[model samples]
Target: MLENTLAATYTPGVNLKHNVAGANWTFLLPRFALDTIVCYGVPGQKALKTLARISNNLVIVAAEASTQTMPPGVRLHSGPATSLPLPARTVDLIYIATRDAQRLIERDGDACDELARVLKADGFIYTEAGVSAGWLSQQSARLGQAVRYWLTPLLGEAQTAVPEVDAATRRYFVENDLFSSSVRLAAIGFGKRRQPAAEAAGDAANAPLRTGGRSGKRRLRQKLRPLAAALQQAAGRVEGQVHLLGKPLARRGVLIGPEVGPGIPQYLANIAAEAGVDLRGWRWGLAARGEYSSRKVLIFLFPPDEQRPSLIVKMVREAGFNARLENEYRALRWLVENGIGDAATLPQPVFSGYHGGLMLVGETIIDGTPFRAADGVETGELAERGLNWLVELATTTANTGVASAETVAAGLEVLLERYIEIYEPGAGERAFLAEQVDAIRRSRQPFPLVFQHGDPGVWNVIVTPDRRTAFLDWEAAEIHGMPLWDLFYYWRSVAIDVSRRQGVQDALAGFERQFLHESPLNATLSLAIRRVCDATGLSAALVRPLFYLCWMHRALKQATLLPRNQLAQSHYHNLLAFCIEHQDAPALAKLLLAGRAEPQVSG
Candidate 1:
């Protein structure tokens, strides 16, 4: 009875496209329809909006609500494109944009039922969707909390004990739906739809989709890649409160900013008094703001002068306090060597959480005298310039199209070697190597742990116009267990350099090539040393199996990482082949042949 009323009362919306007396469906035949039903869920809004603007008889049904109060001249009703609100066999044509089948299933099969009812026996349904942003069909601890959240809300009493709807909401999707068939996780149907009997039964030659439409549609979907990336980048903004401001300072030729962080103004004042610069009488202004995570920053401006323009004050949050300082060319030198350079020694374990700091100082000849003192103290240049140089080289590689692998590897190698130099083991290098190796071998591969920049990619390593390298985003620095861990973590960044051919190989090659061309002997010795060092650390007597297993596990786990890190796939396959060729598991022939999988014994 309801269906009969719906059909009798169905007064077509405004015929804006064909309002003339002579106008008819013949002009729009094969292209236009009496009604255009758009399925909108997840990301279908874009397409729905586009079609609504260009077509005359367009209507949108909210996927979640199953109903809508559309604009004048537009129809609204509950139902999927395959099904309609009118009758059992009414819809002349149906259109469904891409949406998740699992999500639709969670909505109590309304999508499927609507499609089944409204789609005419001889009519057709045009639909599109992809697995790109679809949800999981099942549950697993490894699948993460987001999937669980998405399912929990829509599933309602079906997933729990709320029991409000049908007695079969939960089981309906898994039991009989064509789209879903699992509990913990069954399948992910990104964009699946049912065609009317005619569309489905059409001969291969008469197929409307035979004109390579799938490829074109896929290309259209790929256009969302940038949007996805933008969303990912903005994800961080959602979590934190950020503030920005401008500050002005009294002096020129000053690169003012935080060194250790927000409190540096006190320290800078002391230095100014020592330098006979009466900052007490100088009108220097400071501005500060903070991100919600306790990371406060400061910016400063300077008085314009003939020799130097306005200076900017900066601040950084370190060790729970706002450490403030000025950027002086000379001060920058001091910080680089002592704070950054000295800290670069390999094996010189970071004081765990002490992410490195930077200080800047400038030098200028005041009245025929080269001013060497800041806060009336001396500045060091050797260590600072040296570290700065290495940073420069790494940045250059990153910008010159060297693969991310190569640029980051070079940085990590430099960092590790510097740590080794600074720490200076009291015992022989070999003895020390043996102990560390044995300890590491006995334990599971420690997750990356040495405290270094958490994200050591190109953008974070900011370079100045004057050729100085200043590392930003010290926030992500962390402690991972092995030097190689840093290398491996950095290697993962090659995904950012996807445009390069053989990106991974070429990136790894960058480190080697740079070494060979600039420091051949050092490069050769370093490789030999690392092989011995790592071998000792793992304590796995046979290099082949240990090497292979280590790489294989990393690849397996990383290759399938969420958000689809493509670089891991290439690295995993390449290293898997390498490991297979190198493995000497014959010693464990019994375990392999008998299927008694056990760790291969190592000396």
Candidate 2:
């Protein structure tokens, strides 16, 4: 719920689209083989985006066409909730807000018969109605002692008085990490309802929801969940606290990871100062905190008057996280020196130094809005921009010699071996993985070596309204990697996030649609792929192989970060496994194996 912090950063592009109902979709969507879904009343844009992506027959029902808004693929039906446009027992899912439920209620105060008439027996009507803002305040006092409230003051933590905003309850989201968009997480929130249409027909248990038709007393917790930490206990005035420059910075909650020392913040401020940046009154927020042992942390120094962060400070949490920060520092310096910074819109490095054996690198924040997924046209444009930048970087940094097939195979094999070791796949899984590696080897292909933006996930990207894109988080970049890694990675990353809430199979279906099927965006993606191959003398035959190999590279990277048992939980592991399982699945096989023009193996 870092809405405030994200707003301050100017990058809350699509994150705001998600709401309490959208959160419910994580568990809700995966349960059904959805074809027809009636979004009763107006749900958030996130639900529509998700519904549109998963299935085509998403009909938004409302009182009138004038009252409802329709996104790209969905239809709009003018009707009351009591009488849906669809036939009986047709819709696999019915999503309605509790207020809408109350509005549809007759003197009987029950509206589920019409809803039940249209929904399948096994289908779930996922209804989420929120309590009042006052309810949140009342519950804040009842909050568990999750916040010891403060760590040591020496670590730059402080408890301050509440700011003017009523968001002391926000710390609950922070401690809970409600900002996470990960799909597999099983955490359920308070007052969420999941009932069958048949079962809910006569239920009065849901009547309490009908009592408040949003009479100004009710609000979704998601909408009111501000970005703050720790409510004020004694004065009954809700307040949150965190320290900025060792003094109490009112209202702002502690973000990810603890500040190492009082001197570190000063040191970061000093770097910005030396770089001619004046952040006297700027608020410093911890944007990311990595694994426990490898606590690499990212701190954003938000300028008081500006939308974009003035400076971003990244510090090493431990020895395991050291090299990447150092690599990112070097990568930024190299790009700036080589004049490739603007092509990709990379950050400008300000200063680098070691404090207490942990490395901290300060860089000027890239100014733009974060990229939003689910729209093919915009994503297509983003793909073109990202791929075009990759081409320029390759031309600048590449040796321009044919990449040795043996060298490529060796690196691919190392990734394969690591995957086997970490994931310990079944025999079929292992054989499919080996066959994938062998395909890369058999292709006597000599692909161009490109400077890869290792993890070009959409979240790492932020764009100006004009579409001038800036890429962030360069810790995973490679000096000389296989061509099209960034392009493929960008598309896969976006699809994974889009299909994530639906689970592994949903991701596979999305992949098939994107890579194999003749999708609207596929042409855009295909053209971008062709541009890379055209620029580097690479073949289309290598496209399928390279696409498969990109996941291997990601698998290796994730293995280094996540522990053994948790590696399977990683998105990359699941995607890689699912791809192998469907190796010969009709569409993918036809796409990958057709027109088998060979690029010769070095062996």
All models: lDDT? Answer: 0.28, 0.50
In order of appearance, the predictions have TM-scores of 0.25, 0.53
RMSD of each: 27.6, 22.6
> Residue by residue across 1-603, what tens digits does model 2's lDDT show?
111111121111111111211222222122333678776666665455546554558887766553335667788766555666678767766665335543453222224467657766444444333223442232233221111112111212111211212132234223323122221111243323211111011111111111224434333431222211112121122111232222342222211112112112455566556767665666544433221323345565555555445677776534345666787888788778877766337788887766434577888866565665224434356655765665677656654463565566666776667667666778977776676667666665455677766667666777755667678888766666667778766776555443432342233455655655655445555666665666666656777777677776555554543334344544456666667766666655555543324454534
lDDT, model 1? 0.28
Please provide, for model 1 over 1-603, each residue's C-alpha lDDT reduced to its tens digit, 9 standing for 90 to 100. Answer: 011111121111211111111111111112222343433342233234334433465545544553333444555544553454466655544444335543453354555566546544444343222222232222111122111110111211111111112113222211211111012110132221111010111111111111124655544433443444355335323211110010111011111111211122344444444646433322222222211212222222223222221233333322222221221232234334444433222111111111113232222211111111112111223213323343332222222122222232333333323323333323443243333334334433211122233233333333333333333333323222122332333322322222122232232233223222333322332343244334323222222222323333333322222112222223433433432433343422211122112254433
Task: For model 2, give the RMSD to the true fold.
Answer: 22.6
What is candidate 2's TM-score against the reference? Answer: 0.53
Q: Between which residue pairs do clashes occur in model 2?
A: 162-239, 444-599, 444-600, 444-601, 445-599, 445-600
